[model samples]
Target chain A: MRKNDMRPDELLKMDRRLVLSATGGMAAVMLPVVLTSFIVSETARVVAAVLVYAAAIIMAWAFVKRYVGILNAQHRESEKKHLSEIAMLVQPITTHLNNRALIIPVLTNQLNEVTKQTESAALDIGEKFMSIVQRARNQAKKASGAFGRFAGNGGSSSESLTDLSKKALSDVIESLRDMVGVTSQTLKNMEVIIEDAGNIKRIVTEIEYIAEQTNLLALNAAIEAAHAGEQGRGFAIVADEVRKLSDRSNAAADDIRKLISRVETDIKGIYSKTEKSITESSARSLEAETVVNDTLRKIDDVIGEVKKQLDELGAETESLAKDISSIVISMQFQDITRQRIEHVIEPLMSFKAELEDITQKARSMSEKIHEWEGNSSAEWLEKMYTMESEREVLKEVLKNG
Target chain B: MGKTVLIVDDSASMRQLVSFALRDAGYDVIDAINGKDAMSKLNGTKIEMVITDLNMPEMDGIEFIKQVRNNPGYKFTPIVMLTTESQESKKQEGKQAGASGWIVKPFTPEQLIDIVKKFAR
Candidate 1:
């Protein structure tokens, strides 16, 4: 497959096939089979000529053999190219396979180590951090709940207060309406009272006129009675009394008209102020409604924000919960890892444990290590420990004996 | 003394989740939405631990980690890759990028707390 192992000009060998086929052409010309048929046919002499011609044909065939040298050289070069191409294709694959074989075990060990560490860490974390997470979640829940309660309380109360304000404003407006209605009635009643006052004034005027007429008549009668001298004196005195009564009646009617006029003036003043107050109260109620609407909108916005926060908090707590479950699964791995590692290192660990303290404790170390490191089935270690324990027991028995 | 941890994840829920576990283990929590946000927070804040998601919309976790380690402030800070990946190549890449360690995702609240305590503390 080396490059130089093959000669150059490998493709030129295709011409050798053409050269070898060209040799068949000479058979036609040299054999002259048709010519033989035209001439005297055949015998040893003709056969000798044929043999000589065949010899020439054989000798000329050397040219064809020479062409194979080029062909072989070309073949060799192509074989080399093919071999190199194949090598190019295979090299990386082989390298990869080998690399994988080498890396798998080592990587698996490292991964296992990582798995073990993560597990133990998880257990330690689960035992330690679970409470913390739970506590945090609990606290968060509590805080959110408190905030929610506070939000609900504050929002509702504010809403209530605004509502109450609105209601009070409405009540005031309604009361004002009633007041206006009553005032309007009072104004109408005042108009009627004013008309009555005018009627009283007209009646008083009539009474005055009647009184003047009656007084005039009574005077006439008194004058007439004077003319008749003594006989008429009694009649004239009676007429004078009648005139005095009419004057007293006129004075009383005048006093009643003055009282009515005073009342009408007071009513007119009150009606003017009441109309103005009604207009002001209506404006105030409208202003109050606008303020309530604005406040309500603000409170609604705050509630919306709080609700969004609460939703976020809820999702976070749920995520925290999921994390806890994964951690627990990791703890299971931790337990298995602990046993696996303990078994792998039991002898070493036991030796360490021994150096620390191994009197009565040494007796249980085998079983303890066995139970702890279940994956490590070092039966020989177990046998060795059993022999030691048995020997110790025998010594004790002998001493007691 | 508790560790200060900064969680950088696009999801608000995820950040809250990590914050809960970390804060519970006596760690103070800081948060960022993505790598750019984390970088900004880091520049403005003091944090020794950062838990970040690998895949994010703007500035993924890997690039962020690389940038963080390159910066003077976070040369030795523990940057734990919190992800749902188990690919060795990705881990190798993370290692190459100067990740301190990795924690697989969908982790239990307890496990996350444990891991944060282990690395952060």
Candidate 2:
């Protein structure tokens, strides 16, 4: 109803109900008397019957009219009360829906923002993890390659080193054997020379003895020559020739003895020097073999150490690769979590949509209530009255009144 | 050349995880960002097995599996779905698409390797 539309404030306002009761009582008293008068006066019966029917019809019409007014007034009051109650219910519902609608979008936006940020962060972490894993894998590959190369080269070098050591030992032994052969040959030659020198000394000594004998014979001949003066002169010349030959033989034997002594001394010095050289060469050959063996052993040790270090490096790289891989695996939690969050957000999005729908419904309901408020009581009753049976009851009461 | 395994996932982290695990187990791993990318990478490669995610940007795992089954080269190749989805309907779809198995997310590397070994080798 319009806000300015008001009920009457008069203390004595006669409603349709009072008019109906008064008219109903009058009809109740007059109807019976008029019927009895028609029985008593037969000649006037038609006129009295017409007057009674006319009075009854007029009272019934007034009663129906007043009762209809009562019914309309009650209907308007009930409609207004119902509309007021509906407004009271719709206001809070609209408010709640509005608040929820506002809050839901904000929540959805925040969720979206958070989801975006989480996704970005997860991507960042994944990229970093991939980088680390890639670097680690590359390093492991390089280390493995290095280790393989080192092992390969170490094997070949070790073989080469062993061959070299064997060759060096063989050369040393061969050189020692050559020195022994040369030294022995030199000694044998010196021995042969010494034997020949001895033989020469023996021959010279024999010559000297011959020369001594000749000298003795020459002396005897000279004595005999003194006894037979002139005849002995020819024999004395022969004896003197023999004495000169003997002296020359003795001088040559002395020269041969001196030469044999110096030759023997020189041969002894050469033999001593050759013996010393052979001894030193044998010792040096042994020392050289030992040195070569030591060097080979050192090379072997170095190769073994290098191999061990390479193996260790390979192992470390493998371990590092494993660790980086594990870290990458751990970082996968972000993707899983992101998917989980998206799953949760799916329902949340549905809920938001439902809330929006509810908010829209509430808004429409509120608008309907506001439109209802503009309606007059009669209009509301005409539009909202659904009880045909109640109208029939109201008509009967109206006719009885 | 070792046994080759193809890993398909939109998530880089998941791909890296699978790649690292497979590579560590002495298998050659080929990873792709999605099913479409996996298909592109699958060309001319001797792939023994495939591990793919169900949800992806271009082509999904089921469709990818179906495509792989359609291809003459990969018709008999064992394809497995790696995903967070455990729904029976999705699994049935994968199976219908010629998938060999399903492995859920957050799975252990050993679990993956064991499954790969079972099929790839």
Candidate 3:
């Protein structure tokens, strides 16, 4: 009989009655009646011996049988206890196995896919960074070359700084575009997974519904098999088997439900990740755009300021020209005063000449640096840096002036 | 060009997975269900590498490795033990039984391929 089919109360009832019956009336008859019949005679001695022996044997057999039966009952009780323990452990074990069995495959597939995605992402980021570095390196080389030129002959410095800023801005924008591409592609893939998971959830729920129907059908079959009584013994076993399988299948469906829920959760997680990645990419793009705009604004502002300074220098230069013209024209009539003015004017003109050369070199170096930034041309970059250092010297001369 | 390898494990699914990865990495592969069956396949095959499980029935992997080592057909074959168990005695036994290397189970494709490439023909 099936363990579940047996009732504990009924078992206890039968066990108690069995132990009591053997020691009761059977013991009463076997113990006394035969001993009382024993008499003193040769034939009677044999007959009495036989009767007493028979009583003892019967009583002994009954006692031993009861003891063994009780022993068996105890053993059965222990076995039942063991079964319960096993049953309790069964859920976790089955659940664990079921989870592992599904999870291994699901995660394996996800890991493979995600690894591919992340590797590509990392590669993309590395490539972007390298490109940015290359741009910066080229720009630095140009500035160095301008400095080398400028050091050889003093030149302007403001233009070179502006060129470097523009190149940095454009390069950053390019890398930002690549990052955006990767982020969008990843988001698209994640969306597809989310849709697929949703579809799978729907299918799993349908399957669960069908399993519930199957369980009900199996129950009806079991009831029908029961009504058949003796004729349905084989049918009942078959029905029971079907019912067991259905219950197991139902349990399997529940596992799938849980798995589907987990998958949906994981998909949502991935979606969130994709969203976060996109958000980060967008934010980076925005930051890059802002940097570029700010750089442009700084360049324009510096150009405007430099132009204003150059205009002031021009006005000063015009006044120096007027003073020289006046001194040359009136020098004979006012030689002493004119000579003194000439002494001061000569140095001022020398200063103006030096300033003009410095400013011209600075502009040349800036152009070379800008060219290198655009074409990544090392030759131009080398020239630009040489000019930058010259620009630095000129700025010092102007400061002294 | 890459190493030619044979993977012997009882699980069909695991075989499919490992082979998929190894093949993806450009390795030639042969497959078998278990140790006994692996031996039978090994007789006429020229597999340069063998990655086998430890706890298979009917001629377990260790015994198969021993027999393979004894046979002239595979004396120099590099045999790696792949299994889930981590008992020290089991590892020692595998090493004494002539295993070339040992790796725990649930390794990634990269890890598997990384190890395989180290001895792959």
Candidate 4:
């Protein structure tokens, strides 16, 4: 039968048996005493019987009290043993909690160092990046401005490449125009020389005609002198000499006419060649001017493209600097994480302390385990919370629980 | 030379964080492990401000603030409590112990700098 099912008498049967056995043995010894007392006198025998009954009752009471005392001692010993066992079981858990609590600070310290280093590095990177970007921006601006001036976009006082190219091309075109003007003037002078050559040819033709006529006249005079015979011998000799002079003059006139005709032909040939040269030079000058202008325009376009690219580079660098700043700002989470870990460490340390107290109490078995009290869970939860979010969670838990 | 600020906390990470923020803001920072250590560091230095955490060993922030208030040199120095404790009772205790301001933990660098600029001499 289960112990709870036992009757009160059955539960006390051992004590009752001890009391009855003691009473029975004492009564047997007391009965002989009472009978011996009867030999003295009736009153003495009655008093002796009463004394025997009292002695038996006293002996039974002492025996039962001793047995109960032994049982109580055994129960106390068992309780102490159980408490010690509990202490032994709890010791390792307390130690583990203590170790965790002790190491958390160390871990946080190391984390702090790591975070500090990272923050310093990130800040340094940001500062350096900003500095570099600033420098690059300044350089790019300068380059863009210079290119603008070179491309003649900005109204810079200094001569730009486009302006210079235009000026040089203008100078070349003006020089070509001047050359064409000079060639035209030369062609006009050639025309005047051709006209003068015609006049010289006409004069030479006139001299040739005069010389031929004089020769004919002298020949007629000589014939007439021959017909007059001896008397006109003297006149005939003179006419004959005149005729020889006329013949020589006519030959000289013929040479002069031939020379003038060749001179006219050479002057006409020079005029025709000079006119063709002037026409070709004018065409080439126009082509050269067109090519120079087109080249200048292409150069201007290239400079514009370079300036645009430089501006984009500067903008991109500025964006990178902003990103670095954001990264440096994000590093603040390390401290927040450290606080959260500390919250955990605090509870573990408290638990360790309470466990240690319990273990000490259990070991001694002098203090009641139920008497021990620690901070309430709510109090611990409230105390451990360091952040608003944690407090909100606590509120939720309390509200729900 | 910049203004000097002292940071007192038991957690190394917290001290580092506060120190980093203050230093980044161009303030000279001196850090101590706890209230007792912080007290020892107050030796005639021209500390413009003190930011400390509560629940430190050797001496807590409240007692440290009281001690600082007791000292004639630091009596009027602005002491701001930087701690995890957000309870009104703790805040009142800190205020009564002569804290000039209170900042909960996990504060942004901007907030810390703003408070420093507002209070530091």
Instruction: Give residue A219's lDDT in candidate 2 (0 to 100).
Output: 86
| Model 3 lDDT tens row, A1-401 | 34355589857766676677666657656655556555556677666666776767787776667666655555555555555555555545545544454444454455446544544544344344435444554655564465444232224454465566566778888888888888788878877877887787788777767777777877887788889988877887877777777778778767877887788788788879778878888898988788788868876775666555555655555454333323322211222222234445556556555555554554455455444333332322333344777667655654675
Q: Score candidate 2 by DockQ.
A: 0.50
lDDT tens digits, residue span A1-401, model 2? 33334356421233445665776777666775757574767656767777777777777776666566655665566666677787788778867866776776677677767767766775576567657666766876676566455334544454454455566677877887788788879988998898888998999899899999999999899878877799999888888988999999999999998999899889988988987887887788788767877876776686678777767866776677666666656666777876777777778778877877877886787677666655554354443445888666655654675
Candidate 2 on B17-96: residue-level lDDT in tens? 68877887889998998889988999879999999999888898888999899999999999989988888999999999
lDDT of 2 at B56: 87
Report the TM-score of candidate 2, chain A only.
0.62
RMSD per candidate (Å) reads: 30.4, 8.2, 72.2, 17.0
| Worst lDDT 10-window in candidate 4 chain A | A366-375
What TM-score does chain B alone reach in each candidate, compared with the true chain B? Answer: 0.92, 0.96, 0.93, 0.97
Residue A118 accuracy (lDDT) in model 2: 67
Classified by CAPRI criteria, candidate 3 counts as incorrect
Superposition TM-score, candidate 3 onto the true structure: 0.28
**Candidate 4, residue A212: lDDT:** 73
Interface DockQ of each model: 0.05, 0.50, 0.01, 0.10
Q: Candidate 2 docking category? A: medium
Per-candidate TM-score against the hidden true structure = 0.37, 0.70, 0.28, 0.47
Off by over 4 Å in 1: A1-124, A127-231, A304-401, B1-121
Model 3 ranges off by over 4 Å:
A1-161, A173-188, A223-238, A266-288, A307-401, B1-121
Model 1 sits at a Cα RMSD from the real structure of: 30.4
What lDDT would each prediction earn against the true structure?
0.66, 0.76, 0.65, 0.72
